[model samples]
Target: MAHHRTFDLLSRLPKVDLHLHLDGSVKPETLLELALHQGIDLPVYDREGLIPHMRVGEECGSLIEYLSKFHFTTRIMQSGEALERIAYEVVQQSAEHNCKYVEVRFAPQLHRNNGLTVEETIHHVVEGMKRGQRDFGVRGGVIAICMRNHSCQSNLEVIEAAAQFVGKGVVAVDLAGDEAAYPPEFFREVFAESTRLGIPVTIHAGEAAGAVNVYEAVTNLGAVRIGHGVRLKENRSILEMVKERRIPLEMCPISNIQTKAVSSWEAYPIREYLEQGLLVTINTDNPSVSGTDITNEYRVLSDRFGFTAPELVKLIMNGVDAAFLDEADKLLLRREMENEISSLGVSL
Candidate 1:
């Protein structure tokens, strides 16, 4: 234990991130390039100047405020070329940080503010991700997202578009944004359509809303996974349901604090959830926006929760289990991580 630097070991370990946001994952340099190519005027051109606009700090009061940061990045992603390039960069960055698998989520309607159709938007992302896997050996796909704030009819269209790409490069469908104002109750028909289309469902619930939203997501929306289920802890019955059903919770500690999902790091429920038998996976909700990555997440969490080698392996495996990969692929990924960790000389 003394011989190994925990960060080094964690960095080399294979990882999975199921909650990352494609719109929020744009590289600062890439943002500048897209802005330049599109003639979009930004307040800053350099990385130092551009990064602050992309990220939120303690001043970020609520989920909606934190979401305001995406205006810069998402505005730049209107073109298919820009989306493809950003997708490629996401894979390259994930691979560089040793992520074996990842699922980048984005609302297709965001890109459609320009002339791009939803299908075209997904096609470009798929092509970019395919190219990344071809060159970088990191395999992953996209989760098409339905924004909660949209009209119900519009959300149904988004899910319909997502359903078309289910086997192509898209893995699942997720509901994101302003969950407090737009509860899962209103989106039942939208996700019901997803389940009917054979697309797996994950919802952003109990995030800006209460545990009741989490309950509605599970019972009404047919959500197989809950994104940022922090507030679920507020309701014992709902918490027990999540634990009893073994629904994976995508817990992002950094973004949770930045969005005030929890009051502080000490208040975050990762350790408590794990101890209480809730299946939990650590993820970077947005790498660029949160200014963190998979390795950095594992390390910071280790510092706060006192996670050792075996516990760290549990965290990584939790990600593998919760990943959208098929069973055989999950087995292969598990073996790859185990072999890599073993070769790194860290006993797990």
Candidate 2:
């Protein structure tokens, strides 16, 4: 396909993003503005410093260093008002990128440094999402994230807060943050509780860790989706299980390359996972942090992995199917996305 044609087609294709972090999506300009307003000093305040950190370059040598960039963004988002504004901006940015629906995840515990209770943190983000939906006509849901390194009790508390907001825009629970330090087995009870409440669960596994993390997430934590599950390719048994179970892997190629999860886009296991019949969906895990969007991700896949228009469409459908929303909403969004793709004259 011609590059411009592919770009145009991808831009017009209605899509759903299943994996995106709220704090990680803060735009550099927005971060600078927020920092100035709050009088917070950051090393990378100028465009020169900010641009390098935003892109998937030498700055992100490892997942830990990649995450350190968020410290600058999250430092300014200490209040409920800041969280709400950033959430609204996240949804608005998604809509601008032609996303029809998005599941935005965030670790609320990280926001409590300003003495804001967990409930209050959820309230701020949920309110922002609601406002964005009402204003931009893009449907969204919040996934409450529990950091892995935290104690099991802390994870349970986050899950309890998520349970409280079940029908109120908080649709799911997730395990994230520093995969190497904490394993998925540590949060078995939390995942069980989330499953018992009928809330969907996903875990950040196989990104910085090994395939064992992915296996534990599925068998031990009951994860329906695996975040950055590129490592699952190393273990055939786990790969087979993921394929048989039809678990979705939210593959963020740019973020993976930036965080050293994989060497390059061509080396990414997204094609391997797709060929093995594991439901794989493309996403920009953190657009601002990775200096990418859905369009850029699609372009990278198409260019490096030789994904055709139909293949990209299938990826979008996979995301819609794997979303945490209700069946009725999924059916509705699927139909709408298909219609949009059809309008682009792309054969699927």
The prediction achieving the highest lDDT against the true structure is 1
Best by TM-score: 1
Root-mean-square deviation of candidate 2? 1.7
TM-scores for the candidates? 0.97, 0.95
Give the Cα lDDT of each candidate.
Answer: 0.88, 0.86
lDDT of 1: 0.88
lDDT (Cα, tens digit) per residue for candidate 1, span 1-348: 752577677888888888999988999999998899899999988989988899887678989888998888888899999999999989999999999888988888889878999889989998899999998998897998998888888788878888888878899999998887888899888888898998999999888878999999999999999998999889999999999888999988889888888888888888888889898998999998888988889988888889878888888888888888889988998889889878877676
Cα-based lDDT at residue 172, candidate 2: 85
Alpha-carbon deviation at 52 in model 1, angstroms: 1.2
